[model samples]
Target chain A: MEIRKKRRICLVVAYDGTNYQGWQIQQNGNTIEAELNRALSALTKEPIEVSGASRTDSGVHARCNYAVFDTAVRMPGDKFSYALNQRLPEDIRVRKSYEVSPDWHPRKCSSKKTYEYRIFNDEFPDPLCRLYTHFTYTKLDTDRMNTAAGYLIGEHDFKSFCSIHTQTETTVRTITDLSVKKEGSLITIRVTGTGFLYNMVRIIAGTLIEVGNGKYPPEHIKEILQHCDRSCAGPTAPARGLTLVEYEFL
Target chain B: MEIRKKRRICLVVAYDGTNYQGWQIQQNGNTIEAELNRALSALTKEPIEVSGASRTDSGVHARCNYAVFDTAVRMPGDKFSYALNQRLPEDIRVRKSYEVSPDWHPRKCSSKKTYEYRIFNDEFPDPLCRLYTHFTYTKLDTDRMNTAAGYLIGEHDFKSFCSIHTQTETTVRTITDLSVKKEGSLITIRVTGTGFLYNMVRIIAGTLIEVGNGKYPPEHIKEILQHCDRSCAGPTAPARGLTLVEYEFL
Candidate 1:
């Protein structure tokens, strides 16, 4: 008797995330994960399920994300990106694919994740940029936002910046870097960390926005972190403005 | 007799243009002009007709297109922007509105118009930028594109760049400036001119793209111009990539 060992394939995925639910499968609506599973099943002539690294919220885009699936088909793993792209919608795409160790799982490994929140700080919204940018009428001071962000650069309990519905065991996380940058009426909040709680980046973005608009001083971030209460944080910004820009396994 | 004289209101209009049939009032499709007229007539209980400075093609965006309409509504001119924005769709916006001379038609006076064509030179299309950029896998040489654009800067009978079906009597036009700039994966071809023929900017963008991709030498632009035939130029690039960025009356 001969035994055939299944091979694991990993994909670098990018999606606009405007039309579907987030990366996880759900009952009420379609999602990026479901779309990928459907495309993979149709292509490989089997029911294939993929494990995703991040379950981003609906309307939150991703420039670089990871997903893994096991298959017993004889096709080359690198060719899966081209094959899957033909079946997937234009809003979602598989950037690259390669074979990985069969025992490796995407979400179980230690990884660094980066997100960017874009704000169009102008008198009026530029219609062409409405989909990708959050519009704010008041001018933002990036210097103040940067100073506030600098206080969140080390290890701390991020419960204040997390959603109350989050089921994570611990809210303590290490933020490796945080910065606010501005150019030509556009403000960007970029955050990188080893891991994040649900809505942590968005709450941080909203809090920094408050600092930039003079609602709160730079030192307010320290107090919010000390409180470690979700009510102490600012609002979670619109999901449309957040994007998972980078993900890498350590 | 009490008289209420109609005032001319000029608008700085911006639109995504991805979902509308350009700026003209076409019978078979929804248009920016039709939407503006609908919003205006509904806001003020009167029929309104507008004169547009540029009738951009379908899928072509505009950041600063001008439109003027006469109205007897007692609403203040500057407040029109705010009022109309509430009635218009999210994809179209009135950036500014002010009173203009009663006879100051948007198209009759000499004006300098600037258009930019964006190309995303990358290995794969970024879904976030797909609506605003033309994706090309081939790397572009901006230096070569700039050199080619320099030849088209002065006055020239741009017959080779105009569309074959253009109804204009003559193709003579003055190009004020032309340059190619690159930032990261985005390449911008900005051209300013006194006037443009039908599809002139798109043809020029296509020709420059060919020059950048090594299909033609930089000096080939002069020969193409002197030929005085539409077939001498490259194909008309996609309308989605072109944007009317600036318009100013001389």
Candidate 2:
């Protein structure tokens, strides 16, 4: 007799993280992961628990977020995306789905994630895009931002750049690429990394904005990294301005 | 003895009509206009009212919707937009503001309005854009859709093209321009008119889709218009695909 492999489901999710606490199994208040659990349970008529790749903080966004869950349903993995999307809210979407091994975990997967931070470098605020973008009146030198970003391209001890409450065994991670570009009033900072600590991207963005605004020189980034102290870094940028754009698996 | 001047506040409003009934003040349920009234009353400390250029139906989108409200407040017209956006939801925004003459009404001003309908003509529905786009799998003929759209241009009696429940005094309207373009799996229908009746744009889109799907020839649109019978027209398209792009004040 031929044995059929057990089905493990993988979900690619997109969400407006404005309202939720974060993408985690929160015990208090609302969270994107909790909502997905509710939606998936309703769709599959079973208790569907999921583990997300990143526990993105409140007010953050994800264009191609990932999650993995195990289920014994007879539906094909690809068909689960359509079923889940039909039950999800307008702000959250299950973009893709696939089958995986029962041991597969979104958080444990070997992957490189790309995040983009948007800053509206304008004098007046845009009413339509206030939620998704950060507005600053001071002129930002994109060249300066780019120059500062280049200093942190290699693997480094990012303890000084992460949040104080971050619970991680390793503070070392590889930042493969970073670039800044301006279009109209929008300044987009794209960063690619093997892994990021809690509030790591936001702190980097905040420090870069400081560099762009002349508060800190591009060379100051080198000192901050060498010190490995959180106080040496700039303030954390607001969560709304940061978005997880994409992720590539190895 | 001095004459009191009337203050006409021009508003550029944007909305995601997924939850609300539409841009008009409907008695059935919630609406963008009604929400605006509530927000305006809280801002001005007066029961403010507004008239929209187009009473878009439920689930329609607006990039720069037009509205005019007459108020006696001492607040500057430009500042009203800024203040209102602070109190509005993330999806709705006031893009701009201006003061116009008392006679310059958003609904009555002689100009043109542009509406775009997006059709996701694909085999599978898009998970990322479930709410913002309409999905169809009939394999539309762009040549036929474009040819049928051309017949809609110029002044004509659009009685059969509009919803039967439209209670407008004029069934005759001037459609200044109509164009259809296909990009990959997306088909965009751009329509500009002096004014539109209830469900006019959606009905036109449905009629064009019929022609593109080979249910009717491109020439059938002209015949449908001449019939002046509601039954001769095609089905009404869903409101999700329609977007009020902008209005040009000539």
Give the best candidate by lDDT: 1
TM-score of candidate 2 relative to the true fold:
0.83
Error of 1 at A161 (Å): 0.8
Query: Native contacts recovered by candidate 2, as a share?
Result: 0.12
Q: Alpha-carbon error at A242 in model 1, in Å? A: 0.3
Q: Which candidate number has the best DockQ?
A: 1
- TM-score for each candidate, following the candidate numbering: 0.97, 0.83
Off by over 4 Å in 1: A1-4
Among all windows of 10 consecutive residues in model 1 chain B, the one with the lowest summed lDDT is: B123-132
Instruction: List the candidate 2 regions with Cα displacement exceeding 4 Å.
Output: A1-5, A30-32, A35-48, A72-74, A86-92, A102-108, A120-144, A184-186, A211-220, B1-6, B38-47, B87-91, B120-131, B135-144, B181-187, B211-219
lDDT string, candidate 1, B1-250, tens digits: 8678999999999999889899999989999999999999999878997789999999999999999999988888999999999999999999999999899998999899999999989877788888888888899999999999999998999999999987888899999999999999999999999999999999999999999999999999999999999998998999889999999888
For model 2, report DockQ.
Answer: 0.23
Q: Give one digit per residue, the lDDT tens place, for model 1 in A1-250.
A: 7666799999999999888788899998999999999999999997999999999999899999899999988899899998998899888888899999998987989999999999999988999889888999987899999999999999999999999998988999999999999999889999999999999998999999899999999999999999999999889999989999999789
What are the lDDT figures for the candidates, one per model? 0.93, 0.86
Q: How many residue pairs clash in each candidate at the backbone level?
A: 0, 0
- Chain A superposition TM-score per model: 0.98, 0.95
Backbone collision tally, model 2: 0
Local accuracy of candidate 2 as per-residue lDDT tens digits, A53-78: 88899889888889998776789889
